[model samples]
Target: MPLSSEPKLISGNANRPLASAIARRMSMHRALNVELVDARVERFNDGEIFVEMFENVRGQDMFIIQPTSNPANDNLMELLIMTDALRRSSAQRITAVIPYFGYARQDRRAKARTPISAKLVANMLTEAGVERVLTMDLHAAQIQGFFDIPVDNLYASPVFALDIKHHFRGNIDDVMVVSPDVGGVARARELAKRINAPLAIVDKRREKAGEVAEMTVIGDVSGKSCIIVDDICDTAGTLCKAAETLINAGAAEVHAYITHGVLSGPAVERIENSVMKSLVITDSIEAPEPVANARNIRIVPTAPLFAQAIMSIWQGNSVSSLFDHETLSTIYDGFYSAS
Candidate 1:
């Protein structure tokens, strides 16, 4: 692979808009020798999946843009089938560009006899003839090691940081980055460092899988505007509860910077009624209707970053620099500062 060489970009049914946005950023036309096969996914009488890829892809460098988000099983099957199709067609290489990898939360078996679904998915991909994977902000970083093939785990921090800088430019001094839980302290710390702001942590207890009970703030959030940072926001119970706690601690306002907006169940409604001033998310996953229409929710694009990475991989260049904070700052300064 070389930077000068271009790979054919193909997309599945999931998140076509984001895929089109990425293609546009790469200056690619829709029908310019690139084809997206219509995968007629259906269920049999026994409730099993059936997938079909209707395109020719011989000797091509194929990149399948399929985010295994909601309806995770269907999308996953589609991606697997597409990979098999490309392999059967004698494609040179196949990269699964999964912007938001679903089932990533199940990377570890927290309980006895529990299955590690993330690793299972990785094995499925490898078995389906996928040569590599390109994804962003996985729920667990360790999931990368699950795959035997090269996994380029991209970050959405650069995109989110830019948006944060633009939205709170003059008031940077009042900003405090807060991690919703102990597990996310590192992620919050990174964002805080990027903006040169103080970092805080919320010490809360999760009584059950989807239920969170707020306890106390681990850091000083009083009298300062707070922004909670995390990898994903599903149900938003933890985020909203943390916001309420921060507000009670005398914080001026509370906001959130979540990479993937899963927004399942009553998430959008919960955020609408919660103390969070706003919730910023990246377009890694196709946002649901309620989230898309919510007033407090904002989506930042990650197309440019993905395009750059794809270009680097195609050019056989190092993509490690793309993850560097300084490099990100320089690249996104204009975009964020102007907002």
Candidate 2:
């Protein structure tokens, strides 16, 4: 990697808390001194967005930490406009660090007369001057192909594995990793292999929209501590239902480790009223008040991981080098214990 001045960190309103956490993590890095860029994002009364950089970014590597979450359209537009500002200001390379990529579920045309919205978003990002994309646990793996630039799709498997280990501790041998549905089997299998636990799947049939038919456990989960693993948890209807099904199948305890916690609609209420012991999610999306007040919800910060990736990209090291389970375990040891 040729010298491009230094890494300049910036963010939009989408996820300032996560951006700040990442900045703090970068500051803690003994190798480099990183700080948030002094920038401004303003909106016109008519609902248009405007971004301005108060500080210099000429020939600098700009990393924008903005998760397209909640108000997806507004936050997404802010990112594209901010990237344009940095590009026009002569930034060497611009990377969009989108933790929760919205419209990911629309990667394909599920029905006729529909568009592949995920591909459209990818095209929009490339057109907006994004040289690279750093995101986590995309809804569909193939969405990476939609971009002309490089895309780093990080996984939460390492963090989840480390937490599962610490959670089970001495009772590790009696644990089972479960996928809430068939689609998540691979994710659950990866975590199961990490912790050397058996894999289980929850098979549920839906008779119609908004209704689930009878559910069954595919593998033996009875009398074992079961940990369900999934990438996203939105609404949490399926997740809460899966937890209850696990308990009904005679599992000793049920827990969930999900990457993106959209937690929209009545998710908080469902989780609070569900039979699961606890639900663990990464801070990929900013937590709202209702979720922040939930009793059984636990959050493990992804800032440390993102900080490490940013440092590696700046230093010309391999981004994939950070995926090792043992390495991530050591990186987040303190926060894991606290959470």
Candidate 3:
């Protein structure tokens, strides 16, 4: 499907490959008059950010592709500044397409003095001239309420389920989708339902703040191929530990499918040395060098899903089909084959 006019697509330094892939995907359609805006987003020696657009964006529907991932502060600043620049240039609409939203883990105040950073970021974007927001697998769904403007939060489960069905259809009878924590049960259940597999949850409890969490499986995983599904993989502490616990609990093999791989600190090393079969992550965040070279880590593209959603939003079409496994599976699989 194509729009009446070409939308302006611009990207910051956060994830150029994803942005370019999205542009490439949309341009494949003959009827889609698409244009990737020429822009430069850089920082000065004094640590000040600078944004300059080479093309005219007046009255154009602009979408900025920038994931606030690693170096979160810098990337987030770029998004804010770019939105401000687009608004100042008289663009018709500005949509912030953040594949991996930063500060999402701080959606609520767990402690007395803590700040709801997620809400603060939402307020910041709206104030900076972002009329719409499109992100994937938000840590907390309630974060959507923080924004006054329209926010389209996408799920990566469709892609993951499709991949699971395609690759493991032969042995899916023995597969079980596992949630890393009780909070993620709904997400896990959705994937399990899509694949017609059983669902399980991991009960994690920590004695102290700095102590490792004690994990216990809440369902039968004996002789089952367990796949842990979660939204983020920061530090990889809980994830590696959960994999070990599942293996000890008689799981046939342990694999992880996390949406955003904000693998920081010793995450790569811990995952490399863990007993898990493999760790799969989406290209929501720009992966670091170690993650790319890790023996057991794999990355799948989210570009096609994003491009599909962008086109739907711009065309005023229903995005509900994106959540259907039968419909999206075909679209998801076709993107890889054609890409």
Candidate 4:
């Protein structure tokens, strides 16, 4: 693919490894032309944030790669400040390449007096002068409509499918794809169809944040190796609970395929104690130290896929083929067996 002469990739302190990996995949050195000034966020007499960017981005097609993961607020503030700085610098265009969009679960007002924080965030991005957004596997697909700017919502399914195929060979019959909750049924079904496996749903109820009660399995998982799929695994409550339910339902083994691994709080310990054999996640969010040290956790690099998309967009090429089911299925089968 021909590279765009004006494409400039910038990254924040968060997930620098992913940014570096993406840069390598894109065949470019770290974007040294631009510099990110530390905001030095500190508390005054009270408590508030203070941010500032120490670089100039005038007339540049800047892509800020930052995953709103752990320290979501701080990372988010950094992105906002960076965007503001880029705008003030007179950059040609500003694209926010967020691998994991935080606060995305609250896309709509769940209660009468609630706020749609996802839309609020979108408005903030727009206010900060973000021209476009490039993100993957949003908590809710409809959140894209919140942004008036062009939003490219990428899928980790294609990447995960390739890995699954390589690891499982062509024996998809023994595999079952599972959604941890009803909300993720569509994602699970898509992956299931790609792998030619039956789909299952873990009927669960969230008593509160960080707590999940698994009611029952909606589909037959007996005698099958199950793969629980979801957009994000934060506290691992839903995933671990679903894994236990699958195993109790006579599943041969339970594994999880999640896009973003926000393994916070007791998530690592929970996964370690759960019935899950392995937890596969993409490097969308930077894995914490505890998660990186865990035996059951495996991370797949998404740098190549993101790089490909960036290259395609730069070349003004269609990226729909990247989401093709048959092509994805073959890739998944190959990756499953290889791994």
Task: Please give, for residues 132-177, the per-residue lDDT of candidate 1 as tens digits.
Answer: 8999988888999999999999887767777777888889899999
Candidate 3 Cα outliers beyond 4 Å, as residue runs: 1-4, 30-33, 334-339
Clashes of each: 3, 0, 0, 20
Q: Clashing pairs in model 3?
A: none
**lDDT per residue, candidate 2, 1-339, as tens digits?**
735656789989998999998998888863567789998998999999999889989988899999999899998999999998998999989999999999999999888999999999999999989999999999989999999999999999988888887777889999999999899888888888888889999998999977888789998888998898999999999998899899988999999999999999999999999998899999899999888889999998899999988878877889896778787866776756422
TM-score of 1: 0.91
Rank order (by TM-score, best first)? 2, 3, 1, 4
Q: Give the top-scoring candidate (TM-score).
A: 2
* Candidate 2 runs further than 4 Å off: 336-339
- Report the lDDT tens digits of candidate 3 across residue range 3-122: 337777999999998998888878884256465788889999999999999999998889999999878999999999999999999998899999999999899989899899999999
Q: Estimate each model's TM-score.
A: 0.91, 0.97, 0.96, 0.87
lDDT of 2 at 9: 93
Clashing pairs in 2: none
What does each candidate score in C-alpha RMSD? 2.8, 1.7, 2.1, 3.9
lDDT of 4 by residue, 98-172 (tens): 999999999988779999999999999999999889899999999999999989888888777777877777566
Model 4 CA deviation exceeding 4 Å by range: 1-4, 28-56, 205-214, 325-339
lDDT of each: 0.83, 0.89, 0.89, 0.80
Worst 10 residues of 3 by lDDT: 330-339
Worst 10 residues of 2 by lDDT: 330-339
Decreasing lDDT order of the candidates: 2, 3, 1, 4
